[model samples]
Target: MAPPATQFELAQPPNDAISALAFSPDSPSRLLASSWDKNVYLYDTLRNSEEGAHGTLLRTFEHRAPVLDVCFGRDGNEAFSAGMDWQVRRIDLESGEQTTLSKHAAPVRRVVYSKEHSLLISASWDSTLHVHDPTNPSLGPLAIPLPGKPHAIAASPSKLVVAMTSRLVHIYDLSALSASLSSHPDQQQQQPPQPWQQRESSLKFLTRAVAAMPSDAGYATSSIEGRVAVEWFDASAESQARKYAFKCHRTAQPQTDGGGSTATTDVVYPVNALAFHPVHGSTFASGGGDATVALWDAEAKRRMKVYQKFADSVAALAFSPDGRYLAVGVCPGFETGMEDYSGEGRTKIFVRELGENEALPKGKGK
Candidate 1:
């Protein structure tokens, strides 16, 4: 297979680690990145470029604390972000106006927007999921309590999946959640709605990240042990039997002993991020502390390709809406404090152009 080609790297990258990278649903070329630098940057990937020029930076939204995650609004002209400040804020891309939506007692980890429902879901370390309606703020935000701190969250058009500590994955119906929140404006007083489905993760380690499949076949969850599991939503025996897990993001290093080189040690890197191709439901990408990004064909149960290693750990990954480009955010893993870097830290974002042959299945490739 031919090596993946990087289209361009951000010219002036973030000073700190990047927490999340998102491509606009409406505009595939528009990308947003949140970082520990306490800023969210908007980039236009379609901008005209001279040879070797980077993507154009549209604007930057400043935050009081490190921005952990960001998602674009329905129209693609606005974005919402949350992070270390324990607050969720919305920014207008055109006017540059900012509005505080909600606050949490603990740091917010993830925020995602549902274009179909016009709702914003924010998960925090406080063990609560806040559902916000941008169209009607007067209804206020509804906070749903969770069993434990959320490690990661992934959303589909109609469903929201929250992976919390203790190996719990809660799946909620978006329509049902919106209705329940509307009926009970006081989320504190009313009982939270039961999840559509609740399942214990099959992995032994803590869940690190999740990405919902485009076709809603199921969602893929990754663990810190360098393994990933594909779980189908259908609970039938046949479907359940198809669910499986595999190890990746690891390497075996041979020991330099004089004993004929038989000894080797296995090094495992945490799977930090996952993103599914918008067009091909069975294909997805996983990034890890090993500083490499790999593409997999989950249906075939094998890796299709692995991109070249980046400067630091691959913290986040995203595919454009049209599947024409893949965005990778390279930074140090947050498990270690950002300030504890032993060497000069490098944070970069790369956009790789994907041809039809690159994204399609092996048999379908031109």
Candidate 2:
């Protein structure tokens, strides 16, 4: 069967490339997208469905530099954004009010909020992770130094995972980290977080993205070399044996060799974004330079479905909190010359309604 059609496309999207897409935690119809144009946009996914119109742009939040990542607060009334300006800002969705939360020495790559712990985590290229309390912004954020520059970060209910450029993966117990911070408020100036476990990344290429499984079973990590790894938090031999990596987002080009024989050269495309279904933990979608979004069944160890290719690279992706829709951000990746991005280079975000069969894999017992 053919894949579902795009429910609606954002109207007048950013002129620059989109960097991230996030769904509201409390409302599935609300989505937030960040772009290199230095703006974060909020869209109501259902605004035009019945009328056959474009998605409504509810609001736009301005930033000093290119926004890289965005995440909604638990209430879904606030959003946190990190960007190239070395700053993290919070936006009041209803009032359009903005507040600076923290600053970094280098560009921040990603920001995540943990509703369970009431903490906001920001990972920066400066090789540090900052934890802040949105409720108490005046207290200043706690900084934890890293071994290398961080590329991606994801958090589950109980664990926070960080993937760095040097092929390093650090897993932290969120409950423990929150308890330690709360117990030693006085030592906030000197204490650094103790990671629950640290291991060299299984993939050899630079990590591009990491996503925590909704069930808190394990996490998935994708690399620029067109590879993805599924890893479990369990240290037991049976669980560890299930951890593995596979290649995707690639193609083979056939070339004539000196012997008049054709040889195929493998070309690798970077895996840019990944999002697991909020309800079906075993199913996750990956978008990449290949310009396609493919859903995978990690437990079944196979590709369930591959969506049609977009006009350009798929830069970011997000599954709605209710698992009813998927938001895809498409744009010319960094390889595109910025000089050609003026008049006709605007990027777009597409929301696709997911059917029950698509949301749940066969025999998964979700």
Candidate 3:
């Protein structure tokens, strides 16, 4: 259990808007954040949680171009990054050696590794997924085509969820992906594995982020519009009927016309990030252009906690392995009619150590 509501801001944060944040499954104190500034940052969460503590910057991995996402490999000693440079690279956390795993046709947006399956998967704007088994580098990666460019991808114990443009969502079985790589070379070359299930997104807008439930029951997806939908992997009609979507990260603002009359307008901000608690499977969190982070209970459909506003739009979020800490990445959000964007001076990362009962579902929603 963590101290009550004890939170601190990390020092030496990314110089650009954060693309993603990930915590090491093997080490609760290890954290990683990828940024548009062509770098991936490593931080020590335990050091930053102390009283009067600013975050501890552990190491920096510089890339040729902006890194879109990062994730822990099989252990805390390794990491993988997806890049705007159209490359997927693996980093040795100890020696800081970077190795190019594969180059995609377009920018790579997300990378997720499934330790259970020994697979490293990267989703790219090229509308394809490059699957690699880090343990067996000689076999090479297998490329699987997609219906749309993937924007976000995540891995559960048994499944892979890829959320893409035009409201496309695809779920792939990790075991199948693993088997394809280890099978005879001719079979893999003749045919690539297909998604186990493909479904149109429940949300109408472009999908922004996706997170797989630790329980492997389903996943939650957020969109450019301020909305989130939860769906289970079970294809049964009864299970599918339980799927739901909700509105969040929006505010009602009074609009003033040049003529002087004022009217209330609903301002909807993009839901930029979503993270599920590892300890409490039914509880998850979302951050948005509203610069706020909210916790919700999926089973109960209730709002649990809403942290105070950050300095800017919340770009990325991750729950620590034990679910005791939540890391939030903040930067200026790109709004309608904006001509320029930069997170250089304003980028920040906030880590909150939750109380034992803070994120636990309290009961059914009212």
Best by lDDT: 3
lDDT, model 1: 0.87
**Clashes in candidate 1: how many?**
0
Order candidates by TM-score, high to low: 3, 2, 1
lDDT of each: 0.87, 0.88, 0.90
283, model 3: CA deviation in Å?
A: 0.4
Error of model 3, residue 318, in angstroms: 0.5
Clashing pairs in 2: none
Between prediction 1 and prediction 3, which has the larger lDDT?
3
Tens digit of lDDT per residue, candidate 2, span 264-290? 998888999999999989899999888
List residue ranges in candidate 3 displaced over 4 A: 1-3, 48-53, 256-263, 336-338, 364-366
Residue-pair clashes per prediction, in order, are: 0, 0, 0
Error of 2 at 246 (Å): 0.4
lDDT (Cα, tens digit) per residue for candidate 3, span 13-106: 8999899999998877789999999999999877754455686889999999999899999899899999989999999988999999999999
TM-scores of all candidate predictions against the true structure:
0.94, 0.94, 0.94
**Runs of candidate 2 exceeding 4 Å displacement:** 1-7, 49-52, 188-190, 336-346
RMSD of 3: 2.5
Model 3 CA lDDT for position 39:
95
